[model samples]
Target: MLSLGVRQLDDILGGGVEEGSSVAFVGSIEYDNVILMHQAVLEALKAGKRVLVVDFRQPPSTLLKELRNHGIDYEPFLDDSLTILDGYSNLYGQGIQGGRNVLPNPLDLGITTAIIREALQGDEYDILVIDDVTSQYTLQSSPKIYIKAVVRLVNSVKSLGKTTFVAVCSDVFEKSDLAAILIPFDYVVEVSKGVVEVKRSLQPLRVVEPKFAYMRTRNGISPMKEHYQSLEGLKAQLRAGENGTIWLKDLRVQILEEVTERSLIETVYDFLGPEKGKELLYTWGKKQFIGYGEYSKRHNTSIEEALEDIFKFTIASGGGKLELVELSDSVIIIRGTNLFPSGKGYPYPFHPNYAGSLAQFLTEFTGERWEGEETKCEAMGAEHCEFVLRKVR
Candidate 1:
């Protein structure tokens, strides 16, 4: 038996999870299912089990950092007890080299299968951790094909007497589709609305009566008594997950499209003219900030705290790293590094979207109308972007 490291969860599972059984963690990103995966990994490692992590979400390095941040000593097990199959770099076409198990092409099912087989050859790993199964849908032409592939992979792992722990975002699937996907797993754990329940249990079947409720903190999961103290505290556990979705409490935001920095700039300039395009982009940014500000106010969050939270959210979503350089009654200055929306080779200053965002951030925070301008931009040969917001009139 492999323990999940949580006492209540273990008892619910009839002491512990069965070996060679495939367990599916079904949930949306807000529930911190990824942390559950990390906890399982730590437990498996402590039990002297060699683990294989097939990551399809983020860069393996970033995943490792998060695992470490959760206080899991994964580094010591690296290349020996732990081997990560990086599916992120190749899937995104970065082709980053120097990983033990780097996929040449993640979209190719055959390559993916062969790589996992190679890693599992000779009973090398006792546990298989697929950080997520939802990402496979993005690679396949049809959902039916990917579900078959998942079943095949799970069956193959079980054949080697290895355990499988996989995560699936329940929100991304239809009710029928989710049921179909869960059919292969021996155990299905559903995490939703701060409740962890055993949705399916075939191996020595047991019921989780009264459903286990838990609150996730930075350290780890804790069994909740009655209810969460703060809704905003729950919202603070933001995560970017499967299908390019960002979760904030119950809100699900999807990234609809991807455009290159230069193309976005040129297209806007050509379609709307530079001045109108800039104005439109600025309004877009301001609208985004205003919506967030309103949401924060509704939650009874202080403006200062809301500003900091938005900055962190921006960085987490790959917007950029922002630092408050200066703040006074009349002026606010923000320094941005590696701003994702800014192009490096442009001949002129080009970050009106960010400038507009800064203006709205100030206007909403201070209750004073503000105008913002980009004083320094990487597009204009500056090392970083600087936005200066001054009170209007």
Candidate 2:
């Protein structure tokens, strides 16, 4: 199987396209099928696989130039690993000057079929891509002839144990005719507007809903997720004096591990002294709270909702088991079990800086100065840890 290079799309494709499989991409004008094909070609080349691309939209030189403009280095792979079947030049009675395999009469189904079969005879290619297969019907007498030629070519490549992708415009042929033509393919995907939907597939028995939106980046095209869109929206808001979400575990790990060599408790005590360390930790927590506050404001969510997410993130990161016992306009109380406490007869009952961090976070989140105290402690021979935050007037 060949990876599509897009993780989510690959998952939807039942772990990528298998060799000898026929996949069709039916795209509307709003969708850029060539870009998708380009991405696939780049991926195949990167995997050190021999690729044969039959270009129907543009001359081989034009295609190579476009690939270069997209930051793809086609020089090293040309002729050796990557081959292009120039279909555009022949249609206009132009002689192929570039070192490309000329499809003498691309409009003729018989000749095109013969050339494709001859090229695939040696099993030299891992992938055979026919870009814009609909272009073959441009001057044809009947769509049936072009359809038969496509099916034959795909089957021929399949017989050679090679993967084939045939791209076609969704609106080019009548609905019934298009369905009939696509019926022979193992997979049929439709790209319309910005959404990519699986119209037909042999595997991935259960299809996922909310068809993916394709997003193009410097690297290439990939399926975009809702969270990613949300992040972008949030980023726009932040740029306009707003805010958003953070990967809490990554932040926590960075602070607790990368930022310091000592343990969370020891670092706080030695660097800032117990009294100052608590204040510093509280300030750090407040910054985190403030960041989340902006996200809540922009998202039209309650501060408590943001806090719930923070609590969930903390627990998920194995910080400890934290429970929100009480939450109000004026005060908040949370109880934690297995809270990281200093081991073996340490002076503190719990990590002092952690208490400070929690205090500041609550203070900023509530828009008021809040004093936090660890009323119950595990290090002090208590069963669990409890933190109480009281509004400080």
Highest-TM-score candidate: 2
The clash number for model 1 is 0
Best by lDDT: 1
For all predicted structures, in order, the TM-scores are: 0.55, 0.59
Q: Model 2, range 1-393, lDDT digits (tens) per residue?
A: 766556555656656766578888788764355566666667778889998888887877777777666555667888789898888887875454444487767777887788888888885888888877777766678887677777777777788888888888877787876877786688777766766677777675223251567655444455543223343422322322125433421231122442242367567767878677656665555555445443333322355655665565555444666778898877778877866432444455454444566666655555677777777766666677778778888
lDDT: worst 10-residue window of model 1: 225-234
* TM-score of candidate 1 against the unseen true structure: 0.55
Error of 1 at 245 (Å): 38
In model 2, what are the clashing residue pairs, if there are any? Answer: none
For model 2, the superposed segments whose C-alpha errors exceed 4 Å read: 68-73, 93-100, 205-207, 226-393
lDDT (tens digit, per residue) of candidate 1 on 169-222? 888776887788778788888777788777777554333162567777655665
Model 1 CA deviation exceeding 4 Å by range: 93-99, 203-210, 226-393
Candidate models: Cα lDDT each? 0.75, 0.66
